[model samples]
Target chain A: EAGVTQFPSHSVIEKGQTVTLRCDPISGHDNLYWYRRVMGKEIKFLLHFVKESKQDESGMPNNRFLAERTGGTYSTLKVQPAELEDSGVYFCASSPIDTYGYTFGSGTRLTVV
Target chain B: GIQVEQSPPDLILQEGANSTLRCNFSDSVNNLQWFHQNPWGQLINLFYIPSGTKQNGRLSATTVATERYSLLYISSSQTTDSGVYFCAVNFNKFYFGSGTKLNVKP
Candidate 1:
C-alpha cells in the first residue's frame, strides 16, 4: 500500500504571498492529520479530519492558516500573506478508525522569505 | 494540554552501540506514540505503545501509563538511526516534546 503523499515536496514564496500545501492520505484511511515543524523545533499538530469533518483544529496558529479536506481524501493547507516565521516542514498523516499508528508523508518544506 | 519531556536532548553513540531514550508526560493519556524523524523530514511511526512493551528488530518501546513515562531503546545502532526521536501524548489533543536527537556515528 502507498503511504501518505504530499505535493510540491518544497515551496518557496515571498512575504505576504499565498501558498498552499497538499496531502493525499493512504487509501481506505478515515483519519487525516496535519502537522508542522518550524526550524529547530519539534513537529506540532495543526488539525485533524475524520473523513470530511474537522475533528480538531486547536493547533492552528492563526486565522491566516486554512485547511480543507475535499471528499475526505486529499487535504490542502493554505497560508495567506505568509510571514518569515511560516517557513518549516509541513507533514500529513493518516490512520484508520483512530488507529494507533499513523503513516506520514515526506513533508513539504515551506520557505517564506 | 499535556507536557511531554524527553531526556538527554542530544545523544551521540558509536555504531553498534545501544541507547535508551526516555519520555515523561505530565498527565494521563489514551494515546502515546514514538516517532523517528529522518533528516529528510519524514516522520516514521516507530511504535504506538500506550502501555507495555513492543519490539521491532533493533528498536523497541515500552510505556508505563501509571508512571506517565515511556522508553525507547535502540540496539545495535547504525548510521541510518541518526535522527530526532519524538514522543507524543494524546490528552484530548496530541502534544509532542522537543525530541531526543540521536547521532549514530559509523
Candidate 2:
C-alpha cells in the first residue's frame, strides 16, 4: 500500500498570500491528521479528521487556518493571509482505527517571506 | 495538554556504537510512537510502543506507560542514524518532544 502523500514538497509564498497544502491518505484509512514543526520548535498537532467529518480541531492555531476532507478521502489545509511565522514543515499522517502506528508523508516545507 | 520532554538534546556517537534516548511525559498516554526524521526531512515511524518492549533488528524501544516514560535504543549506529528522534504521545491530541538530535560519525 502507498503511504500518505503530500503535494508540493516545498512552497514559497509571500506574507498575506494564501496557500493550500494537500494530502492523500492511504487507502481505507479512516483517521487523518495534520501537524507542523516551526523552526526550532517541536512538531505540534493541528487537527484530525475521521472520514469526511472532523474529529478534532482544537489544535488549530487561528481563524486564518482552515481544513477540509471531502468525500472521506483526501484532505486540504488552507492558510489565508499567511504570516512569516507560518514558515515550517507541514506533515500529514493516516492510520487505521485498529492500528497504533500512523503513516506520515514527506511533508511540505512552507516558506512565507 | 500534556508535556513531553526528551533528554540530552544532542548526542554524538561513532559508527558501531550504541545509544539510548529517553522521553518523559507529564501525563498518562494511551498511544506513544517514535519517529526518526532523516536529513532530507522525512518522518519515518520507528515504533508504536505504548507499553512493554519491542525490538526490530538493531533498534529497540520500551515504553513504561505507568511511569510515563519511553526509551529508544539504537545499536551499531550508522551514519544514516544521524537525524532527529522524536517521541510523540497521544491523548486527545498528539504531543511531541523537542527531539534528540543524533550525529553518528564514521
Candidate 3:
C-alpha cells in the first residue's frame, strides 16, 4: 500500500498571493488531519476530516485559510493572501477507523516572501 | 490544550551508541505517537504507543499513560538515526512537542 502523499513538495509565493497544497491519503482511511509548523515552532493542528464531513476545524488559524476534503478521498488546504507568517511546513496524515496511529505525508514547504 | 515537552532538545551520539529520549505531557491523552522527521521533511511514524511497550528492530518506545510520559530508546544507533524525533499527543486535536534533534556521527 502506498503512503500518504502531498503535492508541490515546496512552494514559494509572494505575500498576499494564494497557495493551495494537496494531500492524498492511503486507500480506505477514514480520518484525515492537517498540521503546520512554522520555523522554530512545534507542529500545530489545523483541521480534521472524517469522510466528507469536517470532524473539527477549531485549529484553523484564521479566515484566510481554507481546507476541503472532496469525496473524502483527498484534501486541499488553501491559504488566500498568504502572509509571511504562513511560511512553514504543512503535513497531512490519515488513520484507519480502528487505529489511533496515523500515516503522514512528506510535507509541503511553503515560503511566503 | 495539553502541554508536551521533550527533553535533551539536542543530542550528539556516535554510531553504535545508545540513547534514550523523553517526552512529558501535561494531561491524559487518548492517543500518543512518536515520529521521526528526516532531513527531507518526511515524518515517519515510529510508534503509536498510547501505553505499554513496543519495539521495532533497533528502536523501542514505552508510554506510561498514567504518568503522562513516554520514552524512546534507540540501540546501536546508526548515522541514519540522525534526525528530529517528535512526540505528539491527542486530547481532541493532536499537540506536538518541540522535537529532539539527534546527530549521530559515523
Q: Supply DockQ values for each candidate.
A: 0.65, 0.76, 0.81
Give the TM-score (0 to 1) of chain B in model 1.
0.98
- Candidate 1 lDDT over B35-89, as tens digits, reads 9999987788899888999999999999999999999999999999999999988
Once model 1 is optimally superposed onto the true structure by TM-score, how far is the C-alpha of residue A78 displaced, in angstroms?
A: 0.6
Give candidate 2's error at residue B52 in angstroms. Answer: 1.5
The model with the greatest DockQ is 3
- After superposition, the stretches of candidate 2 with alpha carbons farther than 4 Å from their true spots are none
Model 1, range A1-113, lDDT digits (tens) per residue?
Answer: 89999989989999999999999999989899998999879878999999999999988999999999999889999999899999999999888885666777889999998
User: Model 2: per-residue lDDT, tens digit, B1-106?
Assistant: 8999998799999999999999999998879999999887788899999999999999999999988999999999999999999999988668999999999999
lDDT of 3 by residue, A45-110 (tens): 999999989999988999999999999999999999899999999999999877777888999999
lDDT (C-alpha) at residue A64 in model 3: 99
Q: Which structure is stronger by DockQ: 1 or 2? A: 2
| Interface RMSD for each predicted structure | 1.6, 1.2, 1.0
Q: Which wins on lDDT, candidate 1 or candidate 3?
A: 3
**Candidate 3 lDDT tens digits, B1-106:** 8999998999999999999999999998889999999888878899999999999999999999999999999999999999899999977678999999999999
Question: After aligning candidate 1 to the native by TM-score, how far in Å is the CA of A103 from where it should be?
Answer: 2.1
Report the TM-score of chain B alone for all candidates: 0.98, 0.98, 0.99
CAPRI quality band, candidate 1: medium
State how far residue B102 of model 1 sits from its true place (Å). Answer: 1.1
Quote the lDDT for B71 in model 2: 99
lDDT accuracy of residue B46 in candidate 2: 94
